[model samples]
Target: MAIDSDYTVNSGVTTGVIGMQDPLYLAPGDISGLNPVASPFNDKHYLKWSRAVKMALISMNKVGFITGKYPKPAEIAATYQDWIKADYNVMCWILHSMIPEISESLLYVQSSKQLWDEIKDRYNQANAPFLYQLRKDVMHTIQENNQSVVNYFGKLTSV
Candidate 1:
């Protein structure tokens, strides 16, 4: 089998084979919404919105930009700066779609990971109410008569 030039395999023997690439373009459809969470601080839809945003980033080959794991400057070519800038812009766009309070605080954040971590640390809480809600949801959930098995399973796991 031949590896595609557009895709590069990750290094490190124990890391296994993971392909990496830069997206040809970033499309609106790639992201499920123009704005994911209407009110991130409210802690209501953070889980769903975060998952959607993550999917969008993954599909765009930009997850590493947010995770602080991609395109190490020392390993990249001279054009690395351009790649960083592009990734940063995409990250900022995603952040701006979150909540005004959170987005405004990201003005001085230089890296995607910094912005990502801040939002995550602030809102990714697993407190008592959150746990109770999850338990309640799991207990009350029933496979609707018209719901597919796959959809039912997905709903169950999401909680």
Candidate 2:
């Protein structure tokens, strides 16, 4: 009988990897953050291969926008470099706070009307009461949530 091969067992193997004297077991993710989890196979060796793969993918893009040459099939994976993904989700909220993510290149490309439109849309999104709501997004959503800030501001501004 032909010996049975386990496809799951060999998923971690890659060609052209140097200094891989020890097999990769713990993926980069399973070992990241405060409390880490271990994968069954590579637990005794090192970082989880799955998490490592994800980190490599994350590094290939900014806000998931990739802008680089594709590597040849044989390149060894590199460590992912990125800000927390949640930061991208909070873009509008942050920009509404008079913070923007515009870089020098993007700033010069806009026409005056485009700039005004951007400004108007951002500040005029909600009425005065709702405008105050976003300031508390981080705090309220995280702990001790409330809509009281809106009422207080509404009373003060009377609008």
Candidate 3:
């Protein structure tokens, strides 16, 4: 029996056609390009940008490529080279979407995991004073006499 790309087997017989889309394939504009919303130099904004980028990464299913958790294709597979090429292209596109200051430093780094770790290690440090200030802000926030309930709540949550 000859097998074709659209062939599907049912009960011991080749039956209906099955058109499979590649799960790893990412189309352009599937997700909006992430732009830096805040400067990494500002501690609060650094955290916000980090969160926004992380969310974008998660939505793209490309987070694993940067986290070192994505599976590698078997070396014997004929498409292994193509898979690697495609993955590398995706990684570069994501890396370039970051702020120029951050992305420039990462240009020389080939591995996505390395670039991700370097950024996280440099910016995602523990800061007791910053956290304390944020907590204080949240606690002291109260609905102003003129502020609507919804607006007040939004301000509190943002802090």
Best TM-score among the predictions, by candidate number: 3
The per-residue C-alpha lDDT of model 3 at residue 72 equals: 52
| Candidate 3, pairs of clashing residues | none
lDDT of 1 at 75: 30
- Which candidate's lDDT is highest? 1
Estimate every model's Cα lDDT from 0 to 1: 0.62, 0.29, 0.60
- For every model shown, the clashing-pair count is 0, 7, 0
Kindly list the per-residue Cα lDDT of model 2 for residues 1-159, writing each as its tens digit: 111111122467532221221111223442222211122222221223324323543442211211112111122232111112222222222122221343222244222223323443443344555546645553344212464876656544432
lDDT of 3: 0.60
Ranking by TM-score: 3, 1, 2
What lDDT tens digits, residue by residue, belong to model 1 across residues 1-159? 121223334563222222334432344454423453343434466677777777767767677767766644533443345456556666665766766666777767777777778778877887898788889999999999999999999999977
Error of 1 at 134 (Å): 1.8
Per-residue C-alpha lDDT of model 3 across residues 1-159, encoded as one tens digit per residue? 111334455776754332224424455654333342333333345567767666666666556666666545566543445446545654565565565666677678655666667777877887998899989999999899999999998999889
TM-scores of all predicted structures: 0.61, 0.18, 0.62
Q: Comparing 1 and 2 by lDDT, which wins?
A: 1
lDDT for 46 (candidate 2): 22
Alpha carbon lDDT at 122, candidate 2: 41
Query: Any idea what lDDT model 1 has?
Result: 0.62
